[model samples]
Target: MTTMTTDARFREFKMPDVGEGLTEAEILKWYVQPGDTVTDGQVVCEVETAKAAVELPIPYDGVVHELRFPEGTTVDVGQVIISVDVAPGSAPAEAPAEAAAPAAAPAAPAEETAAEPEGRQPVLVGYGVSQSSTKRRARKEAPGVPAQESGAPAGTYYASPAAAAVQAELNGQAPAEPEAPSARPLAKPPVRKLAKDLGVDLATVTPSGPDGIITREDVHAAVAPAPAAAPVSRETTPAAQAPVQAAPVAAGARETRIPVKGVRKATAAAMVGSAFTAPHVTEFVTVDVTRTMKLVEELKSGKDMQGLRVNPLLLIAKALLVAIKRNPDVNAAWDEAAQEIVLKHYVNLGIAAATPRGLIVPNIKDAHDKTLPELASALGELVSTAREGKTTPAAMQGGTVTITNVGVFGVDTGTPILNPGESAILAVGAIKLQPWVHKGKVKPRQVMTLALSFDHRLVDGELGSKVLADIAAVLEQPKRLITWA
Candidate 1:
């Protein structure tokens, strides 16, 4: 048998373009640190692009050698973020004579010694290492520095090396004391927010998740056994008596400033561009959806539709698909550069979902080909994935039409802006009981309003009106779905 020897080959994993043509992503958190052994296909870090949060998996097995950037740093595509030593037992490559002569060049700059590695290595599909001149800029402050001295703004936290050293010196002269844990408990942002809302201390609760990460269940359990305490009166408190002076006001007490980034930023830019570029015209129609409501109830208890989400939105989506089929001209996009109107044969239906990060419109591919049950299942999975913040960037790309259900929020109707590339978007308002003139009689009926917004360049007034009227007709009479489709 041949013996194997350690080979000192280090591979660098670069930040990839997680979304279609995306240029950058902010490093949210790191799952592996230096000296940690990682396997192939194991997620090492999570990054947030303009579209969604994506977990990147390492393609090769090795020990992590270094993390090039800290958390919350935005890195560009093709820039190396982590280096791994594939062969741990082998010796590292020797540096050049000029680089190694520390005594000879005592005044050499620190940055000159920290040059990036030469050459490229393949890491993932559609992404290979390249010798791009792109580099991460120097942080305003170095790691482990006091926030004020390091030039960090208020409301930000940073570790101070000088403070730690001073504390260590004092501890040597004083009596022995027990050391406290340095790292905080592991928990996601959502879980931490939940714990704060419930007044549950994460450190006191027991973590049952993998790697000691505190989960939502742990926070709920901690809150369940606590006894309700009586409120304290300020007049009877000793601290309240001593502090008669006015308290200092924080800078953000009156107004909060949220950074514009990720999905929210992209959405804002797209809305501004679409509103000004595309001459939009909105048409509204009020229709009685009592029969559609009855069909929704019927589908909920059906054998095939059981365990799936069967709501008015499902039928409303089907109705829009049928309307598009009837008026095929409404399902088209405008190409400004080519000065052409491109009509699509397939329908990629987009559903606007409000996530914690912001609004994201992830679509279903080939939605027109799916049956009612299939559409219901796909809608269920899409909403669930969007809520969990796991919707991929690919899922949100390439759409022909969209639907936004403002009805869920008890609104009558809205003129929604079209998605950047798509031609039309439909807004469905709340279904309410109202007096209607049905069959020459004033009776209470379930009525809803529909608004269709389209790019006037390709879809004229007649086409937009037809699409909206067809959807209203389908909802008014549910049987039209079979005949029209």
Candidate 2:
């Protein structure tokens, strides 16, 4: 039988590591599906790693042939999630006998080329695979098994268990029956991990994703206990002394359990690590910020600060920067591995922002070198990007010091925890009009509290005290920013 070969027309696209050595990402959305024409550099889907949300662009132009995984599925790097037909409209002389096999297969190889030319497949974001590591040896087919009925395609490395079962059926051998469903529950790796962590059985959970796939929400809902029954109202009781029966409570009405993953998961892990590993010491001081508030209003109308976000946080960030300048020793990290205290010359000023994802601290690269207006502009961009959930992993790294404005939530001063690897964190409380002794007379003044938390291993009480005092001084007398800086 003559079989036309059109496999060379198809090309597979593997999931690329979007960030620094990330292993996997959850498919947030898909922009294209099978038969959709896509061009070079066209975004195919959005994926979320532990760090951030990233959109992936297709490298070459083609008509999409298959989507291996659906949305909300977390796929590992180097796994083929998509396949495209580079030559979609090519005519074939004869169709192969095993044409129905590829349709039923979940992971069908696109090509059967023996050798991989150097850089034939381009990896996204400059993370390329080695030329020698790109190709795999073909698996030997079992006796009496057709070429397409083999466990895997020629030169293909990976084959799932489901693919193995398909091979058995193609060979006319029925394998042993399964205890649960005929096929295993459809779920990604991370969702499986979450179910395992929560001690939930995937087979017992009702799947809500497309094609009967289990989602993260489904896993969470599986373990959610039914709400407690409400007490019977006394006025509606048939008899005052009769036994009371509880009213039925609706599901998920009283509380909600949000599964911690992605950015929130990373943040929670980092916070727990920082709290236990580092020896923290927090110092508090209430200061009169009447001068700083006035300065903020003045900078708003100034030509230098035009079109900038000038608020108490702006002046407060500047104040903290000036304080760091006064005490450079406070800008250091404790290297436990080397048993050394590494002091930083440049300061990446971190601003803690709360988003729908979670709290993220994105920092300005070098706040010490920037002018007031430049600092204001950088701060504006940082806050805006963080609020929109576009803060990249690189933006949250290498921070020397941080400022968390709890005042925005109308909170008094809090004992802030030190961000991992950073020396200190400053917490700013709400600025309220309070009666205070100003110029030896009682008057209503703009007052706020400042709390400084630092790693005692690198910053002693004396150094931490000086840094806190300098910040307080800068806020009390705004002119001290120039003198201290």
Clashes per candidate (backbone, < 3 Å): 0, 0
Candidate 1: tens digits of C-alpha lDDT, residues 366-474: 7887788878777776776676667777678788999988777789999999999999999989999999999999999999999999999999999899899999999
Q: Provide TM-scores for the models.
A: 0.68, 0.69
Could you give candidate 2's per-residue lDDT for residues 262-295 as a string of tens digits? 7778888988999999999999999999999998
Checking candidate 2 for backbone clashes, the offending pairs are none
Instruction: Tell me model 2's lDDT, rounded to 2 decimals.
Output: 0.69
Best by lDDT: 1
Worst 10 residues of 2 by lDDT: 232-241
lDDT values, one for every candidate: 0.70, 0.69
RMSD of 1: 17.6
Prediction 1 global C-alpha lDDT: 0.70
Per-model RMSD to reference: 17.6, 18.1
